[model samples]
Target: MSLHADALTTLRDWEAPDDEQEALRRRYLTHLERHPDGMLRAGRPDHVTASTLVLDAAGTSVLLTLHAKSGRWFQVGGHTEPEDATLAGAALREALEETGIARADLALDPVPLLLDAHHVPFCGPGENVHHLDVMFVAHAAASAAPSISEESLDLAWWPVDGLPDAELAPFVARALARRRHAGQAGSASGAAGSSSDGGGSSRAAADQPSR
Candidate 1:
């Protein structure tokens, strides 16, 4: 399926953890319904973007990039590309491209973790643009070392509890919670003779900027 169709299906089937998230989920669905090209950069004013928050294997720290244009610390992500087959794939691609961490060492959770909508003043020619960002989570091997990409001024892994951007605390918390829940669920499923697995921001920098 196309990325747009994949995004629609993903969000439609996603069970939001809270009422606020459910509302945002509906908003994303509505946007897609109104604009067929909503998942692409060409969808003016508003478009869908994908991002991934990278965590250490122990979930102690999160890898962040000091965005070159926004000059703010944020997760690694960006606009969807023609090469991307799905929204989650786009997010994984951004994480890999922006972090310079080997794919072998970075494991992405196919399920999205959060959704954020925010304005970016630098995106449009003269008007601000809103990015409907779908955030995903990933875990990196302890030995994974990230190199800075052109999109970032610097990249580093900061303690999850001591993030440079305080606004990110909530996002990190949610991701960690989901990770733990997945772990528990996996154990439970395995104990039952089987195995099962399942699994935002803005700068006004709330979400990822168009790159």
Candidate 2:
């Protein structure tokens, strides 16, 4: 199967010239060169999905998960199912389900798009194509509680500026940047009435032993 021109056009409209875009194309091409129909398998015109890098009360932090298989910290996202009017909904659904956050509370109407292309381990049965995923920024409420699910092994919020630089997904990092730019900025939990997991909350609870 050939790459969809419409999807390619969308990619062009997604973002301005950057090294990341070029790298994404190369990654997609490399994967397609091996197993075709990878994108088609996902029922996507092209292999893309909207994604979210949700932040918490602390303006300095953002949520990230260690993907079960890859063990890489990344934003929440998945494929664009037919029922989804736009890829963003698909991302929202995936983020909520996979992260066990009841609601993603996506903040933006027209989120900035990031052309993320990368290779992961096998998706499911008969899946082997690399993807040119068009990731977008989505945000969640600071009070949202993120539960670790099977899709993820570890989940946590890290300071945006202090985010680990080693082996971090570029898309996850860029999404954080866009989310903050969109006025979805998070503040470190410190004020009154903060959620349980926020930097605020009760200091007494913070002294509890590991469960």
**Which has the greatest lDDT?**
1
- How large is the C-alpha RMSD of every model relative to the true structure? 8.2, 11.1
Candidate lDDT scores, in order, read 0.86, 0.55
- 1-211, model 2: which lDDT tens digit per residue? 1234334434444545488577775555544444344345463333544566666644457788877777677776666555554444556677777677766343433334566555544655544444566565545667677788777888888877666555444555665455454332223323443655454543222112111
Error of 2 at 142 (Å): 2.3
Q: Where is model 1 more than 4 Å wrong at Cα?
A: 194-211
Candidate 2 ranges with C-alpha deviation above 4 Å: 1-12, 17-46, 124-128, 164-173, 176-211
Predicted candidate 1 versus true structure: per-residue lDDT over 106-178, tens digit per residue: 8888788899998877875648678999999988988897999988999998998799998899999998887
lDDT of 2 at 19: 82
Candidate 1, position 176, lDDT: 89
